[model samples]
Target: MEMSRALDISAAGMDAQSMRLRVIAENLANQDTTGSAPGADPYRRKTITFAETMDRGTGQPEVQVKQIGQDMSDFTTRYEPSHPAADAQGYVKLPNVNNFVELMDMREAERSYSANLNVMQVTRSMLTRTIDLLR
Candidate 1:
Protein backbone atom coordinates (compact mmCIF):
# COMPACT_ATOMS: atom_id res chain seq x y z
CA MET A 1 0.00 0.00 0.00
CA GLU A 2 2.78 2.40 0.84
CA MET A 3 4.61 1.59 -2.35
CA SER A 4 1.48 2.19 -4.39
CA ARG A 5 1.07 5.56 -2.70
CA ALA A 6 4.65 6.46 -3.47
CA LEU A 7 4.03 5.66 -7.10
CA ASP A 8 1.03 7.95 -7.10
CA ILE A 9 3.05 10.77 -5.59
CA SER A 10 5.82 10.41 -8.12
CA ALA A 11 3.31 10.19 -10.97
CA ALA A 12 1.80 13.47 -9.87
CA GLY A 13 5.23 15.08 -9.84
CA MET A 14 5.86 13.86 -13.38
CA ASP A 15 2.60 15.38 -14.52
CA ALA A 16 3.53 18.72 -12.98
CA GLN A 17 6.93 18.71 -14.69
CA SER A 18 5.28 17.86 -18.01
CA MET A 19 3.07 20.88 -17.65
CA ARG A 20 6.07 23.07 -16.88
CA LEU A 21 7.81 21.84 -19.99
CA ARG A 22 4.77 22.64 -22.11
CA VAL A 23 4.71 26.21 -20.83
CA ILE A 24 8.42 26.55 -21.57
CA ALA A 25 7.87 25.28 -25.10
CA GLU A 26 5.13 27.80 -25.65
CA ASN A 27 7.32 30.65 -24.44
CA LEU A 28 10.08 29.55 -26.77
CA ALA A 29 7.71 29.31 -29.71
CA ASN A 30 6.54 32.89 -29.24
CA GLN A 31 9.93 34.37 -28.46
CA ASP A 32 10.00 36.25 -31.74
CA THR A 33 6.39 37.30 -31.70
CA THR A 34 5.86 41.02 -32.05
CA GLY A 35 2.99 43.45 -32.29
CA SER A 36 0.92 42.77 -35.39
CA ALA A 37 -0.52 46.28 -35.78
CA PRO A 38 1.03 49.67 -35.55
CA GLY A 39 1.57 51.10 -32.06
CA ALA A 40 0.56 47.79 -30.49
CA ASP A 41 2.05 45.79 -27.69
CA PRO A 42 4.03 42.69 -28.48
CA TYR A 43 3.84 39.22 -26.96
CA ARG A 44 4.74 38.82 -23.32
CA ARG A 45 6.47 35.74 -21.98
CA LYS A 46 4.54 33.55 -19.53
CA THR A 47 5.71 31.31 -16.75
CA ILE A 48 4.31 28.49 -14.61
CA THR A 49 4.05 28.15 -10.88
CA PHE A 50 3.40 24.96 -8.91
CA ALA A 51 1.94 24.29 -5.50
CA GLU A 52 1.30 21.34 -3.27
CA THR A 53 -2.16 20.67 -1.92
CA MET A 54 -3.98 17.99 -0.03
CA ASP A 55 -6.60 15.90 -1.80
CA ARG A 56 -9.73 16.42 0.25
CA GLY A 57 -11.25 13.06 -0.54
CA THR A 58 -8.11 10.93 -0.62
CA GLY A 59 -6.22 12.77 2.10
CA GLN A 60 -3.10 12.65 -0.05
CA PRO A 61 -0.69 15.44 -0.84
CA GLU A 62 -0.33 16.21 -4.52
CA VAL A 63 1.33 18.71 -6.76
CA GLN A 64 -0.68 21.12 -8.86
CA VAL A 65 -0.17 24.09 -11.18
CA LYS A 66 -0.81 27.18 -9.13
CA GLN A 67 -1.01 29.47 -12.11
CA ILE A 68 0.17 30.37 -15.60
CA GLY A 69 1.56 33.85 -15.17
CA GLN A 70 3.34 36.58 -17.06
CA ASP A 71 7.08 36.98 -16.48
CA MET A 72 6.58 40.53 -15.15
CA SER A 73 10.03 41.44 -16.40
CA ASP A 74 10.49 44.51 -18.51
CA PHE A 75 10.29 44.15 -22.26
CA THR A 76 13.46 44.27 -24.31
CA THR A 77 13.88 47.33 -26.47
CA ARG A 78 15.42 47.38 -29.94
CA TYR A 79 15.86 50.12 -32.46
CA GLU A 80 13.83 49.59 -35.62
CA PRO A 81 12.68 52.93 -36.87
CA SER A 82 11.29 51.48 -40.11
CA HIS A 83 9.30 48.76 -38.40
CA PRO A 84 5.57 49.17 -38.36
CA ALA A 85 5.33 48.67 -34.60
CA ALA A 86 8.19 50.91 -33.78
CA ASP A 87 7.39 53.76 -31.42
CA ALA A 88 7.84 57.47 -32.12
CA GLN A 89 11.35 57.13 -30.74
CA GLY A 90 12.21 54.49 -33.37
CA TYR A 91 12.40 51.79 -30.69
CA VAL A 92 10.27 48.65 -30.42
CA LYS A 93 9.61 46.67 -27.28
CA LEU A 94 10.22 42.97 -27.76
CA PRO A 95 9.15 40.07 -25.58
CA ASN A 96 11.44 39.52 -22.65
CA VAL A 97 11.71 35.81 -23.47
CA ASN A 98 15.19 34.52 -24.17
CA ASN A 99 15.40 31.34 -26.23
CA PHE A 100 18.51 30.11 -24.50
CA VAL A 101 16.92 30.59 -21.08
CA GLU A 102 13.82 28.74 -22.16
CA LEU A 103 15.90 25.86 -23.47
CA MET A 104 17.71 25.57 -20.19
CA ASP A 105 14.42 25.55 -18.30
CA MET A 106 13.14 22.83 -20.62
CA ARG A 107 16.13 20.66 -19.90
CA GLU A 108 15.64 21.06 -16.16
CA ALA A 109 11.99 20.19 -16.40
CA GLU A 110 12.80 17.13 -18.50
CA ARG A 111 15.29 15.86 -15.97
CA SER A 112 12.82 16.35 -13.11
CA TYR A 113 10.16 14.46 -15.06
CA SER A 114 12.58 11.65 -15.81
CA ALA A 115 13.53 11.35 -12.16
CA ASN A 116 9.91 11.02 -11.10
CA LEU A 117 9.32 8.39 -13.73
CA ASN A 118 12.28 6.45 -12.44
CA VAL A 119 10.87 6.57 -8.94
CA MET A 120 7.53 5.25 -10.11
CA GLN A 121 9.19 2.48 -12.08
CA VAL A 122 11.38 1.42 -9.20
CA THR A 123 8.46 1.40 -6.80
CA ARG A 124 6.44 -0.78 -9.17
CA SER A 125 9.32 -3.22 -9.54
CA MET A 126 9.77 -3.47 -5.81
CA LEU A 127 6.08 -4.04 -5.22
CA THR A 128 6.04 -6.77 -7.85
CA ARG A 129 9.03 -8.48 -6.27
CA THR A 130 7.40 -8.36 -2.85
CA ILE A 131 4.26 -9.98 -4.20
CA ASP A 132 6.25 -12.71 -5.89
CA LEU A 133 8.25 -13.43 -2.78
CA LEU A 134 5.03 -13.97 -0.80
CA ARG A 135 3.83 -16.62 -3.25
Candidate 2:
Protein backbone atom coordinates (compact mmCIF):
# COMPACT_ATOMS: atom_id res chain seq x y z
CA MET A 1 0.00 0.00 0.00
CA GLU A 2 2.97 2.28 0.42
CA MET A 3 3.52 2.33 -3.32
CA SER A 4 -0.10 3.11 -3.87
CA ARG A 5 0.23 5.98 -1.43
CA ALA A 6 3.28 7.22 -3.28
CA LEU A 7 1.42 7.15 -6.57
CA ASP A 8 -1.52 8.94 -5.07
CA ILE A 9 0.69 11.63 -3.58
CA SER A 10 2.51 12.18 -6.83
CA ALA A 11 -0.72 12.26 -8.80
CA ALA A 12 -2.08 14.91 -6.47
CA GLY A 13 1.10 16.93 -6.85
CA MET A 14 0.85 16.77 -10.64
CA ASP A 15 -2.74 17.95 -10.49
CA ALA A 16 -1.81 20.89 -8.29
CA GLN A 17 1.07 21.90 -10.55
CA SER A 18 -1.20 21.63 -13.59
CA MET A 19 -3.56 24.11 -11.98
CA ARG A 20 -0.67 26.39 -11.17
CA LEU A 21 0.48 26.24 -14.79
CA ARG A 22 -2.99 27.18 -15.98
CA VAL A 23 -3.10 30.25 -13.77
CA ILE A 24 0.35 31.28 -14.92
CA ALA A 25 -0.71 30.92 -18.55
CA GLU A 26 -3.70 33.13 -17.86
CA ASN A 27 -1.46 35.80 -16.38
CA LEU A 28 0.81 35.66 -19.39
CA ALA A 29 -2.10 35.84 -21.80
CA ASN A 30 -3.45 38.96 -20.13
CA GLN A 31 -0.12 40.66 -19.59
CA ASP A 32 -1.01 43.50 -21.99
CA THR A 33 -4.58 43.82 -20.85
CA THR A 34 -5.24 47.29 -19.49
CA GLY A 35 -8.42 48.77 -18.15
CA SER A 36 -11.26 48.72 -20.68
CA ALA A 37 -12.19 52.32 -19.84
CA PRO A 38 -10.08 55.17 -18.55
CA GLY A 39 -9.13 55.61 -14.89
CA ALA A 40 -9.56 51.90 -14.14
CA ASP A 41 -7.18 49.40 -12.66
CA PRO A 42 -5.09 47.26 -15.03
CA TYR A 43 -5.03 43.49 -15.00
CA ARG A 44 -3.23 42.00 -12.00
CA ARG A 45 -1.25 38.78 -11.86
CA LYS A 46 -2.99 35.86 -10.21
CA THR A 47 -1.12 33.77 -7.66
CA ILE A 48 -1.48 30.10 -6.78
CA THR A 49 -0.68 28.75 -3.33
CA PHE A 50 -0.24 25.07 -2.53
CA ALA A 51 -0.78 23.25 0.74
CA GLU A 52 -0.03 19.74 1.92
CA THR A 53 -2.95 18.15 3.73
CA MET A 54 -3.43 14.75 5.30
CA ASP A 55 -5.74 12.47 3.37
CA ARG A 56 -7.80 10.99 6.20
CA GLY A 57 -8.42 7.66 4.49
CA THR A 58 -4.86 7.12 3.31
CA GLY A 59 -3.08 9.04 6.08
CA GLN A 60 -0.88 10.61 3.46
CA PRO A 61 0.07 14.21 2.96
CA GLU A 62 -1.18 15.31 -0.44
CA VAL A 63 -0.68 18.56 -2.23
CA GLN A 64 -3.75 20.75 -2.69
CA VAL A 65 -4.42 24.19 -4.08
CA LYS A 66 -4.75 26.38 -1.02
CA GLN A 67 -5.65 29.62 -2.66
CA ILE A 68 -5.85 31.45 -5.96
CA GLY A 69 -4.92 34.91 -4.73
CA GLN A 70 -4.15 38.23 -6.39
CA ASP A 71 -0.76 39.91 -6.42
CA MET A 72 -0.91 43.13 -4.42
CA SER A 73 2.23 44.55 -5.98
CA ASP A 74 1.95 47.88 -7.72
CA PHE A 75 1.34 47.91 -11.46
CA THR A 76 3.97 49.26 -13.83
CA THR A 77 3.38 52.60 -15.51
CA ARG A 78 4.53 53.51 -18.98
CA TYR A 79 4.29 56.85 -20.69
CA GLU A 80 2.03 55.98 -23.61
CA PRO A 81 0.27 59.17 -24.54
CA SER A 82 -1.64 57.55 -27.41
CA HIS A 83 -3.02 54.70 -25.35
CA PRO A 84 -6.68 54.90 -24.41
CA ALA A 85 -5.92 53.88 -20.82
CA ALA A 86 -3.44 56.67 -20.30
CA ASP A 87 -3.76 58.87 -17.24
CA ALA A 88 -3.83 62.64 -17.20
CA GLN A 89 -0.03 62.66 -17.19
CA GLY A 90 -0.01 60.48 -20.34
CA TYR A 91 1.11 57.46 -18.34
CA VAL A 92 -0.48 54.10 -19.00
CA LYS A 93 -0.97 51.46 -16.31
CA LEU A 94 0.51 48.12 -17.25
CA PRO A 95 -0.19 44.73 -15.74
CA ASN A 96 2.18 43.54 -13.04
CA VAL A 97 2.94 40.34 -14.92
CA ASN A 98 6.56 40.25 -16.01
CA ASN A 99 7.44 37.97 -18.91
CA PHE A 100 10.77 36.86 -17.48
CA VAL A 101 9.38 36.02 -14.06
CA GLU A 102 6.37 34.25 -15.54
CA LEU A 103 8.57 32.18 -17.82
CA MET A 104 10.75 31.14 -14.91
CA ASP A 105 7.74 30.17 -12.85
CA MET A 106 6.37 28.20 -15.79
CA ARG A 107 9.61 26.29 -16.13
CA GLU A 108 9.60 25.42 -12.44
CA ALA A 109 6.01 24.23 -12.56
CA GLU A 110 6.73 22.10 -15.62
CA ARG A 111 9.68 20.43 -13.96
CA SER A 112 7.69 19.71 -10.83
CA TYR A 113 4.83 18.28 -12.81
CA SER A 114 7.13 16.06 -14.83
CA ALA A 115 8.86 14.78 -11.74
CA ASN A 116 5.56 13.94 -10.13
CA LEU A 117 4.40 12.11 -13.24
CA ASN A 118 7.64 10.12 -13.33
CA VAL A 119 7.12 9.13 -9.72
CA MET A 120 3.59 7.94 -10.40
CA GLN A 121 4.72 5.94 -13.42
CA VAL A 122 7.51 4.28 -11.48
CA THR A 123 5.16 3.39 -8.68
CA ARG A 124 2.69 1.86 -11.11
CA SER A 125 5.40 -0.21 -12.75
CA MET A 126 6.62 -1.48 -9.40
CA LEU A 127 3.12 -2.49 -8.41
CA THR A 128 2.67 -4.27 -11.67
CA ARG A 129 5.89 -6.19 -11.19
CA THR A 130 4.93 -7.16 -7.65
CA ILE A 131 1.62 -8.53 -8.87
CA ASP A 132 3.34 -10.49 -11.65
CA LEU A 133 5.85 -12.02 -9.23
CA LEU A 134 3.05 -13.18 -6.95
CA ARG A 135 1.32 -14.89 -9.83
Candidate 3:
Protein backbone atom coordinates (compact mmCIF):
# COMPACT_ATOMS: atom_id res chain seq x y z
CA MET A 1 0.00 0.00 0.00
CA GLU A 2 2.80 2.39 0.79
CA MET A 3 4.39 1.58 -2.56
CA SER A 4 1.09 2.31 -4.21
CA ARG A 5 1.15 5.71 -2.57
CA ALA A 6 4.58 6.37 -3.98
CA LEU A 7 3.41 5.38 -7.42
CA ASP A 8 0.45 7.70 -7.11
CA ILE A 9 2.64 10.60 -6.10
CA SER A 10 5.02 10.00 -8.96
CA ALA A 11 2.14 9.68 -11.37
CA ALA A 12 0.83 13.06 -10.28
CA GLY A 13 4.23 14.61 -10.83
CA MET A 14 4.52 13.04 -14.26
CA ASP A 15 1.10 14.37 -15.15
CA ALA A 16 2.11 17.87 -14.18
CA GLN A 17 5.33 17.70 -16.15
CA SER A 18 3.49 16.25 -19.11
CA MET A 19 1.27 19.29 -19.21
CA ARG A 20 4.31 21.51 -18.97
CA LEU A 21 5.92 19.73 -21.90
CA ARG A 22 2.79 20.16 -23.93
CA VAL A 23 2.76 23.87 -23.27
CA ILE A 24 6.37 24.17 -24.27
CA ALA A 25 5.72 22.23 -27.45
CA GLU A 26 2.86 24.53 -28.32
CA ASN A 27 5.03 27.58 -27.78
CA LEU A 28 7.68 26.16 -30.08
CA ALA A 29 5.13 25.27 -32.71
CA ASN A 30 3.65 28.75 -32.72
CA GLN A 31 6.87 30.68 -32.67
CA ASP A 32 6.20 31.96 -36.20
CA THR A 33 2.48 32.48 -35.81
CA THR A 34 1.33 36.03 -36.39
CA GLY A 35 -1.90 37.92 -36.65
CA SER A 36 -3.45 37.93 -40.13
CA ALA A 37 -4.45 41.58 -39.97
CA PRO A 38 -2.14 44.54 -39.85
CA GLY A 39 -1.54 46.01 -36.41
CA ALA A 40 -3.18 42.98 -34.79
CA ASP A 41 -1.50 41.35 -31.86
CA PRO A 42 0.62 38.26 -32.54
CA TYR A 43 0.57 34.99 -30.72
CA ARG A 44 1.51 35.13 -27.06
CA ARG A 45 3.66 32.60 -25.32
CA LYS A 46 1.98 30.32 -22.80
CA THR A 47 3.27 29.48 -19.35
CA ILE A 48 2.59 26.72 -16.90
CA THR A 49 2.46 26.94 -13.12
CA PHE A 50 2.78 24.03 -10.76
CA ALA A 51 1.50 23.75 -7.20
CA GLU A 52 1.89 21.10 -4.54
CA THR A 53 -1.40 19.64 -3.44
CA MET A 54 -2.30 17.24 -0.69
CA ASP A 55 -3.83 14.03 -1.86
CA ARG A 56 -7.28 13.62 -0.30
CA GLY A 57 -6.92 9.92 0.39
CA THR A 58 -3.20 9.64 1.14
CA GLY A 59 -2.46 13.13 2.34
CA GLN A 60 0.73 12.98 0.29
CA PRO A 61 2.01 16.07 -1.43
CA GLU A 62 1.85 15.93 -5.21
CA VAL A 63 2.51 18.41 -7.95
CA GLN A 64 -0.35 19.73 -10.05
CA VAL A 65 -0.57 22.27 -12.88
CA LYS A 66 -2.04 25.32 -11.23
CA GLN A 67 -2.57 27.30 -14.37
CA ILE A 68 -1.80 27.57 -18.07
CA GLY A 69 -1.53 31.28 -18.58
CA GLN A 70 -0.19 33.64 -21.21
CA ASP A 71 3.19 35.29 -20.87
CA MET A 72 2.54 39.04 -20.81
CA SER A 73 6.08 39.91 -21.73
CA ASP A 74 6.50 42.30 -24.61
CA PHE A 75 6.42 40.81 -28.08
CA THR A 76 9.41 41.25 -30.33
CA THR A 77 9.04 43.34 -33.47
CA ARG A 78 10.72 43.23 -36.85
CA TYR A 79 10.48 45.47 -39.85
CA GLU A 80 8.68 43.52 -42.55
CA PRO A 81 6.83 45.78 -44.87
CA SER A 82 5.75 42.95 -47.18
CA HIS A 83 4.26 40.84 -44.42
CA PRO A 84 0.52 40.85 -44.02
CA ALA A 85 0.76 41.56 -40.31
CA ALA A 86 2.99 44.57 -40.76
CA ASP A 87 1.81 47.69 -39.03
CA ALA A 88 1.62 51.23 -40.42
CA GLN A 89 5.28 51.65 -39.57
CA GLY A 90 6.17 48.45 -41.46
CA TYR A 91 6.98 46.73 -38.17
CA VAL A 92 5.46 43.32 -37.54
CA LYS A 93 4.85 42.08 -34.04
CA LEU A 94 6.24 38.63 -33.35
CA PRO A 95 5.26 36.11 -30.72
CA ASN A 96 6.96 36.47 -27.40
CA VAL A 97 7.95 32.79 -27.57
CA ASN A 98 11.65 32.25 -27.84
CA ASN A 99 12.98 29.01 -29.27
CA PHE A 100 15.86 28.79 -26.85
CA VAL A 101 13.70 29.32 -23.80
CA GLU A 102 11.08 26.90 -25.05
CA LEU A 103 13.70 24.26 -25.73
CA MET A 104 15.15 24.68 -22.26
CA ASP A 105 11.74 24.43 -20.63
CA MET A 106 10.99 21.37 -22.70
CA ARG A 107 14.19 19.71 -21.58
CA GLU A 108 13.40 20.42 -17.95
CA ALA A 109 9.89 19.08 -18.24
CA GLU A 110 11.15 15.97 -20.02
CA ARG A 111 13.68 15.36 -17.26
CA SER A 112 11.06 15.79 -14.59
CA TYR A 113 8.71 13.41 -16.34
CA SER A 114 11.46 10.84 -16.74
CA ALA A 115 12.39 11.11 -13.09
CA ASN A 116 8.80 10.58 -12.02
CA LEU A 117 8.51 7.61 -14.35
CA ASN A 118 11.67 6.14 -12.86
CA VAL A 119 10.24 6.48 -9.38
CA MET A 120 7.09 4.70 -10.45
CA GLN A 121 9.10 1.95 -12.06
CA VAL A 122 11.21 1.47 -8.97
CA THR A 123 8.16 1.44 -6.75
CA ARG A 124 6.49 -1.15 -8.95
CA SER A 125 9.63 -3.29 -8.88
CA MET A 126 9.71 -3.12 -5.11
CA LEU A 127 6.08 -4.11 -4.93
CA THR A 128 6.74 -7.04 -7.19
CA ARG A 129 9.66 -8.17 -5.10
CA THR A 130 7.59 -7.92 -1.97
CA ILE A 131 4.85 -10.01 -3.50
CA ASP A 132 7.39 -12.58 -4.59
CA LEU A 133 8.81 -12.74 -1.10
CA LEU A 134 5.35 -13.18 0.32
CA ARG A 135 4.88 -16.14 -2.00
> Each prediction's TM-score against the native?
0.92, 0.95, 0.97
Best by TM-score: 3
Q: Candidate 1's residue-wise lDDT over 31-124, tens digit each?
A: 8888976567788898899999887756789898999999888888799999988888888889889988899989999999989999988998
Arranged by TM-score with the best first, the candidates are: 3, 2, 1
TM-score of 1: 0.92
Error of 3 at 30 (Å): 0.5
Range of the 10 consecutive residues with the lowest summed lDDT in candidate 3? 103-112
CA lDDT, every prediction? 0.87, 0.92, 0.92
Clashes (N, CA, C under 3 Å) per candidate: 0, 0, 0
* Residue 69, candidate 1: C-alpha displacement in angstroms: 0.6
The RMSD (Cα, Å) of candidate 1 is 1.4
Global local distance difference test of model 1: 0.87
